[model samples]
Target chain A: MKVVEIRPPYLIFLGSESRATYAKTGAGLAQWRPELCSGQLRLAADTVDLGLPDLTLEQAAEAGVGSLVIGTAAVGGGIPEDWYPVLREALSRGIDVVAGAHKRLAEVPGLSESAAAGGAQLVDVRVPPAELPVGTGKKRRGKRLLMVGTDCAVGKKYSALCLERDMRAAGMKADFRASGQTGIMIAGCGIPMDAVVSDFLSGAAEILSPDNDDDHWDVIEGQGGLFHPGYSSVSTGLLIGSQPDAFVVCHEAGRERISGWDDFPLPSIEDVIARTVELGVLVNPAIHCVGVCVNTSSLAEDERKSYLAQLEKRLVLPCVDPLIDGAEAIVRGLR
Target chain B: MKVVEIRPPYLIFLGSESRATYAKTGAGLAQWRPELCSGQLRLAADTVDLGLPDLTLEQAAEAGVGSLVIGTAAVGGGIPEDWYPVLREALSRGIDVVAGAHKRLAEVPGLSESAAAGGAQLVDVRVPPAELPVGTGKKRRGKRLLMVGTDCAVGKKYSALCLERDMRAAGMKADFRASGQTGIMIAGCGIPMDAVVSDFLSGAAEILSPDNDDDHWDVIEGQGGLFHPGYSSVSTGLLIGSQPDAFVVCHEAGRERISGWDDFPLPSIEDVIARTVELGVLVNPAIHCVGVCVNTSSLAEDERKSYLAQLEKRLVLPCVDPLIDGAEAIVRGLR
Candidate 1:
């Protein structure tokens, strides 16, 4: 239900393949709030760039950039040490910096002093909650809706956010519970599910979903996929931990394989629905799928429309490109 | 494949729970290598104890106990501070101490000094491996076998160990991969999968399962159960990370419900087998259920045989009380 209205003078640092690799994080703000985009920043050696004029850290500070974004895919590595001087310099210059790395900026020694000295903020989107207690198998109240996906970067968060917006607009009680970095930025408060201890992964979900009335709905952003080799564990954890009463399967149009995994082919959408329902029931027998959220970003105008129509016919559930149509159908299904 | 032959005189500190709870840790050594059990130790508590004598830390050292066992289950808590003084005192007297608490003994502020001064060993079983990298989801070279269960303490580890022993005895390439504290102690090296970062849960399993020929079988110990709300995440992670070609369902015979969850009626054995296979194939299409390991310790002698017979008749796959039958039939199913 919460959303950050991204302001002007955005500084997009083109490090870690910002264009194609960290495309979502690098361009999410601009895409969500295009009117607020100042420009993009790139490394001097950048071959393929975002076409915005290259701006140095000092220049960005002088320009009074509201936030310097270091949105890149550093999935398995530590924070790139190269960005340290720039982050510290920005912090000293009264400009906030938002990073979506597995490493937390707050944990960097002396970074807090720089931020405090300049009265600027440091947002590490993937930072986990302070203390995630072990889960007790006690039954909870309220309906939890988790966005399950067929692959990583398949609009799981986007679909969940849309559902929340639509749900709230319809005068329903709904809150977006973020599980990853992008969702965290919009929600303002969320535990980066992938960063916490394994034992507390599902427990994190259990703790995040508040015990509210049956009318209340917590729309949780899911991560990974049961078919994703590198991240299926996380997906499974999210599936069981969130304890969803219903799920929306998110899939990108024409995704033949997982983003990085070539050895694995995508399972049929039918299989994904069946698999999620089975996985969900394993934890909560009453849980089932409500709808399908397809990303038509890769399809053409005619193709996108036809794909949605065909999907709706085949899925036998509400199917929509959540970004375009909102998750009204899913919310309707939930009700 | 490697088993620790515990030597006596054994000093089991009944600090956490001498009998009901932590008896497993205190007496596992004797049960695994009974020839080495000299006696047990206990606090001044006059209640039901592990039947070990009341031996002080000093007496334990004087008696030349090989390892002071502090095996007690402290779910959702830290190592009891009261045991610190005893542990330090024992270390100073040249006696190795084995602790299964989630909190590592070496991390204790001054315990390392006592250990160094006494030339004693400090072994913390639940320590996760340092520097577990992210998984690539590339095809691994070996055939891995995993033992999954319906609940925590349903004998996943015990079944895996049995399978490994039987497979190796039958002239197969087999090794047991530990995923929890007890399994880690038995294996000598493994990341405490539950204690690790959430993203690395599956990654830890990927790193542990070495690349070998398809003929080799990695019998990985699974933690938690999909139905056990507290630990399903760990189970999910183990299942996805291990990427087993085949799985064995581990169940405690004559159990009416989950170990701690009185509300949940036990799912039928058929459902468990079908569910595991379904879950397994979500990650690997060829994955299937090969067998079942029944923990018949709770049943009477005659009942154990009849229950296993009924299970075999109903399940069709190999069924066994691993401790008694040595998992020979389960291994045969895999072959």
Candidate 2:
């Protein structure tokens, strides 16, 4: 079952983030689910623009926005003090304030009281449900496709979202299963994998995507690289719990080292595919790689095509940039 | 650093447990650290005896017991309602009450008030420390050894404790680092691996056994088995965080299936050793297997020796029952 349920028709809040990279959450929501998002809220003049109409709390309320989502992440994933006033005002106006930040919105000094005063909910997507069962390792009755990565932030979420959209477009039954804060926000409901207690990591993953129809597909967003020294445990648990029948290897072009861990180089795509199969077999013996999703935004337009083509030839699998090329090729291979 | 600090001279509470196996926590403490234990307290007539003097609350108080440890585990690891009166009486007498049970001691009704009235601490070994850093995957100074297993409750903790004792006896600088509730209570301090948040599993493990002197050895007690379907994620995180220079494989003789997960067969010792080394090299490239530890309690005296001897020959490593053979053979191989 989904742990947190976030209301849509959101007003994206970009809290003084000048760089688009730092405002990924806001950008992602605006890009992927523009229909659910009503407008944007910026704290400063220099804040990154998500290309949506800017709206104040009064304007957002009048516009019938359901929730104000904090889209910008601070350096340490914390909620800034200046944003608290805006959040309090949003809650005081009877609009729920949703945050994927490290600090819980309900725990902020005056936010909960304001929310109570307006009869609005304070939703913290980062907080997991109180009760989570230990994973039984029993296979569920549905097809699953998990996005495995060679490094953190290598487009696992983007790949999973793209696959879900493309699969549905192709007349297939598919749902996007989010495992991180931003993905959970976009998906409207999901469990925060890393926030769960260690013993229940796999159990939480199992609950995230329960048994479904035989032909249905749950495109699970993966966390951390399997070869990642620090976060591999999270990845491993998600993999085993997901018990995916198929997986897509996600990687970023022009990246040679793991982000924030310079001492360790990123594992090869072949290594990730092999290791994922090795571990994934513990739960799903029929696990296999179906495609490769690479973020080729760093490469030139001409170079991107050739790069994917070469990779497809070498790996003997469909390769594409989920954002630029869409996951139609990958969806075609699922049949 | 250790998360919980339990005091010495413990009074073990067996709490209506008729089976010695269910009273493993009390039995472990009584067997491993008899010097620190004052006596055992049983609530029922047929409670399994640990051979220590049966002490009443009044007798334990007069005997100067530092803490009363609830040693027996109920069916679901929950504290039975019948245990409240005995726990309250112990706390009312100024004796600190320590428990490694799933339920927190302070949350029990009236227990905290009783502890406050008598100025006694209610220690819960299952709770992790508030602050823990994410694992950096940077190599730390000092040598380390970790005990891994093929399934849960297969003598990983016992083997680590045995190795620590034998290593010290052989004039080696060694410390036993606990990672579970029972191990934490036994060692007076440790991080409960399964209790930590999923994101910080490796981080908590990193803090549990920090850097020591160059010659010092941190013998860390392992958690779940690497091949365990439900628990392998915890094992993976701990393995990465511990980054053991040497490891010992733990298994139980006469058991061919995973406990509670009979559908899955127990992985062979060789499979465990190979997998441990494969994953362990991420943090420490020099990681290698030092020996094998088998729980041979179910085997006859003649069968036990032959079992270990054949294992030693096949695996080409020292094989012993930490309880029966004292782990001296494994300690010798460490050097």
Candidate 3:
């Protein structure tokens, strides 16, 4: 496992992505850490933008961009052949190439030599740290809140980031722990839980959120859902490894099926909460659900408000779209 | 992930091991596939023996041994420096080196060159197959029975093998699906579930026990316990991927705590059954526990019978030592 440290002042690569949904990685970085991002680079004129200045390879290098981060994930996580020339040019200019794609940047033909020639590093964000220990199941000192989802891309990362912000604003000691590529690029470090060996899934999660201050709250970003047939193991491992004192169930407002797994239906917020607690207790005896965070971006304004209100009333927990309504209400429940 | 195929007529290498427990791999191979084993190789005179003819590298080569399989796992699964010379010697003799250790055999300095020079292959059994897909969670065609445990090293592998042998003897279509190194060696081919990436844990399990004939039973070997804080994720993933129609709880008699974790106590048979059903039902709605396999070797002869009888009465399920009493009773319950 490799611990990836991506250089900042990034040039976001959109790679001809027309839809904003597929370009969420670039959007997330632009939304969260605008200062670290120097500009955006797109392969096509009609591609989605992250509101950053458009820059060419030479322009990005001239502007002192330290790395070019692939912001859009392609289907199957492969690097498109068309994007190679730009990446090669960036590397030739001593700009580090950072990617979380399944195909490693260094594995691309001639990429390593090009990187060596320009004295630039090629960072693979998906690789985990080496020699991770198996989960001890020993209780850690810090207070931790993990964001669990009903399916993949159901606002777990967003909710966690929001909680960290609100918790800090509310005068609490907190740190947002990233668990995926986008979040890792935003926070500058994290273990890609999905890429870890099955035996060390929980172990890596334990390393991701090590013992901290007694009063500190580690808002750990979560991964796949417990009911997700394909990835439930990753979810279960992360949940157990995190051993969160409290967790928030993150769900999309209107989605009924698992993101890519159409054969399986999504587990309800209640189901997610119940199962998270049921399995979480194996590691943390006192684990409980703190709130619910729903992604209501697809819902109408009225429907979003009503849906959240109905959910809060039914579950007897704070429910909010962390992006829109803010996470103050959820943070209030943490106390 | 690499699908390892070890050639038979094995020379079991028990490297300076004094404890029979530490040399279980050799013991297992000798017990299950005695005809395939030509001889034993020990570094020390007093080391545990598998009752095979003790042979030197020259004698093993003369006896037509195809592989020198490392049959003892060290503290951290590393090949000891002292054993390197012997391994090199075996490779130099054109005997393939087969190891399931954490440190790859190819990574051992000068071993690859020796193997190549002698036209011998280096087999790393822990590496998984490449391009494994995420689990689809779709029910496959076949009846599968999984061996789950209350903790690590609790006879799950032994129980599964026993069931496979017993079920076959009873004129049932059954195949033992190996998930670990020793079992894989016995079965000839299997995915090392623990070595698979976290996201593909279930996928690998799916590949391990693919869709078979309706009457065929894939008795999948299980890994870590669901109650094991360090390895529950592997257990959960395997359970989901196997989608076993039936499961058998494999437990060691009087083992109160998790094998390596002194802090966490073992879950009871009832607890294991309940939770296995609870989690397993997500992938296998018809999942049920058929019987219990207890490793009662630690108990007295009279005590073992009485203990099993009392447990059978309480749990209302067939309870037997798969090794001592045979898995026939459990096989009867499976029908």
Candidate 4:
């Protein structure tokens, strides 16, 4: 007779058979009504205990069990110390054990070898690798982009989103990318697609790369935050791949913290601009221009102009507001 | 006569030199001195009343005061509202007002235009900018580098230091191009260079990339908290400039709010790898391999190896311990 198995933690306790399994195995302990299992149970004569028989596994073993089916329920894909002895005994008796899901278990010590030794094979829960998408032969060209900030929560994404929007609006292809912390978590599988890739494939976006044949410009990938470790790694990877053409940065001091940021050596407008420009030179030799967007809530327009003049004097490129001027300054500076 | 300026919170009462001017020209008080400002007596040719000064320009013409300097002791750039009228009257006379470091008087509405119209120049305490050694043109190709973190404290600098050590150990030319946060802050002028950059420049350590010849790698850029918006922006900026060949991503658990992270859907290891890989792809098309460095306080070698293998298979990359396998796996995967 055929046997159907369910992993533990879903309905029954892990490491043991269900009360329904006891009756199906013909164990003389107690009989289960078909109604108990919604009539989905299959009565099998040769169900066997494959591990340390918890009370339920023991009853099934005593009832002359033959085969064991395993799914993700067993140890959440981790190895449990109690499952070994029963596995060994069952293999010795010529019973087959089938397992699926729980890829991590493939690395559990001696488990794969033991199963293989017993002539059993493990199956993965992922769509057979064949179902995954293949690579498109593409390369990123020279659409240099940069994301920067003065402090945390100071419109970094606003700048990036603006850049993406303005670039597309200006008829230049562009995409926003995530770096730092979000990159790390997402990199591991927190979402359907990593945030960086998501931006690239978004409806209104066009990736900033060489392969997509467009004229005025291709893609202008914008970054999310500053100095995030995960983003740093992801961005480094992108630079190695895409190689953008210009660097755009955002600086803000709407709060009193601007001057008080004296703890940082480059605390003033002059200092921040200088260092960012230098870094830009080191990374993208192709950086044609640099754009700085400043937050102006704390100061008046004249002061803002003065501050802009001061910063502009220091920066090799023009500095402007994204909300006010859009991509015009960036495009002009590059030109 | 030279006048000594004191900081804010001091009361001012008008004196005899201003009573006639106030009656004749309807001009308000002229000069202000802190109550205890007897120390400035020697510097003044005559004494004037200190109070809320009537600020008609004709009063100054009639009083023959020539020029008057109203001192508001605002410190730390905090400008109070009451000072604007006094500042405006003085500006109308083409008087030069020395604003306290804290008072952002220029930020007041109409004050910017007032200062310009009144020919009144606003001055604040300032020190001359310092000069530092710049990068040379003959250093190395692709030597100019920039490094960024995935998130704060995720070991961007530590990794850079290790990479520097390894490069030196292998006899490859390398230098710590930038000091990460310190460098960024210094360039921004948030702090004193004497305390930060000057010390480093004065030390025996070589600084590069001011000119063209110093091909150097920058170490670490970007910023943010543990999750959400860490280094995404800064990393993108760095990538736009430097385009490093590979990336090493360090990962940790997502925010605790994510339920069942250790299991399926929520915090599965697979999600992390996928997200990171997504960002890695944008950074460098050549980046197919992401070295997953699991952060555990301590684990036996066998356990570590087992975990690495599981993550690799799950994430589809060659995972390894930086302390053990070094960059070997990353290099091989990239190749």
Highest-DockQ candidate: 3
B-chain TM-scores per prediction: 0.77, 0.92, 0.91, 0.37
- lDDT, model 4, position A166: 67
lDDT of 3 by residue, B11-120 (tens): 99998999988988888899887888899998887999899999999999888899999899888989999998999999999999999898988899999999998899
Model 2 in CAPRI terms: which quality? medium
- The CA lDDT of each predicted structure is 0.75, 0.91, 0.90, 0.37
TM-score of each: 0.78, 0.92, 0.90, 0.27
Q: For candidate 2, lDDT tens digit of each residue in B1-335? A: 54778888999999889998898889889988899999999888999999999999999999999999988888876888898999999999999999877778877999999999988999988889888888889888899999999999999998999999999999999999999989988888899999898889888888887888999999999999887778999999999999899999999999999899887889999999999998999889999999999999999999999999999889999999989888999898887
Model 2 per-residue lDDT tens digits across residues A5-116: 8887999999888999888888889988899999999888999999899999999999888899988888887888888889899998989999887777777889999999
Q: Which candidate is the best by TM-score?
A: 2
* Per-candidate interface DockQ score: 0.57, 0.78, 0.80, 0.02
Cα displacement (angstroms), candidate 1, residue B60, comes to 13
**Candidate 1, residue B260: CA error in Å?**
2.3
Chain B TM-score against the true chain B, candidate 4: 0.37
In model 1, the runs with Cα more than 4 Å from the true position are A1-99, A106-109, A114-123, A136-139, A283-286, A325-335, B1-23, B33-98, B113-123, B137-139, B171-173, B213-215, B282-286, B332-335
Candidate 4, B141: how far from true, in Å?
38
Worst 10 residues of 3 chain A by lDDT: A1-10
Interface root mean square deviation of every model, in Å? Answer: 1.9, 0.7, 0.8, 16.5
Ranking of candidates on DockQ, top first: 3, 2, 1, 4
Docking class of 3: high
Put down candidate 1 lDDT per residue, B16-98, tens digits, no spaces. Answer: 46346545655554455344444566555553365556677777677777777665666754677777887888888888777
Per-residue lDDT of candidate 4, residues B270-316 (tens digit): 43333334433333344332455444336677787787787788667
